[model samples]
Target: MPTAQATTTTNITSTAIDQKTVPTTKDGLPTILNHWDCRSSQHPTPVIMIHGTFSRQLSQIDVTQMLHDRGYCVFGIDAGHNDNLYTLIKPEYYGTAHVDETTDQVNAFIEKVKRKTGAKKVDLIGHSQGGLIIRNRITRYGGKDVRIAMMLAGTHQGTTLMGASKIVEEAMPHLFPIIAAPL
Candidate 1:
């Protein structure tokens, strides 16, 4: 039972557990469990951070912290989650979803953020496959709430797995399913 507390920041609602602070949406798994309400926040525009390959929202935790420290509202979600053998072994497995699926997740997270923060637009920041997923979300479905987008180690051009996918496609088409499950 973690208690919600705001630490050294304004308008940040986080759970204080083991001296660690984190925010999340209720009934957590894919969405965060932070119960923070930013309706009266100083910064009207919120920033959404997206993590990279085989990564979770924790990968962008530092960025979120930095943004909150600067009085900027920030939010993150576990995108690219998939149900497969990998997740059965490690429930924390993230960024394992296909590009199309991941984009859908991102899109949903954006809508949630908009509703929570009551902001008309949000900034997008992503790493690795997260960058590609952001592009897919914006391209496939119009980025209505996206104000600005920054991609780190963006794979918009392609992915390092392209060669691997090619090699596996030629070597063993049957095993492609194994390498193809994750980015």
Candidate 2:
């Protein structure tokens, strides 16, 4: 079982995990777990890890654990399709969620982390589609709470699917136009 520490910030009490015992990589870094916390940490700012397309917070466990071991409070969330049914049945579709919706969720999570840690700003790390979500939140959704944003393998320009869709658009002319419009 994971070890947890209870912290009282304002009127709220949250359990943060003591990940010292969690498994680590060959380089000696803890593996991040969902909702794991280290609130007693002295670090002023927290770190948020966002998973890529079709993935949940667990996807970036290694990175999160690394940050925690480095003395930063880390958090993660399952944005877009967070429902259990959808996550279990068809996780890939989770990436299909609109950027606006995911960005809103990211913004909210950032606020919550800041309130809990009493930090002025938080750092963000995103992977794949998760990177795009962070970008949208910071650039479009007024996410001034973030101090630094790092993206890994993100779809910043667009997805490669767009190129394939263009080919189909030319081949089918009318049929593919409507089908590939979104891509």
TM-score of each: 0.68, 0.64
lDDT of each: 0.72, 0.70
- On residues 1-183, what C-alpha lDDT tens digit does candidate 2 reach at each position? 999999866543434544455575443333453233456447656788887766666556656755666677777777776544445677544555667888888788888887766777888899998889888987876667778899998898777564776687678988985675443
Candidate 2 C-alpha error for residue 51, in Å:
1.7
Q: Where does model 1 exceed 4 Å of error?
A: 1-36, 39-42, 161-183
Tens digits of per-residue lDDT for model 1, 35-145: 347543576677788887667776566556666666776677777777776676776758777788888888988888887767789888898888888888889878787
Candidate 1: residue 26 Cα off by (Å): 8.8
Best candidate (score: lDDT): 1
Pairs of colliding residues, candidate 1: 23-34, 24-32, 24-33, 24-34, 25-32, 25-33, 25-34
Top model number, TM-score: 1
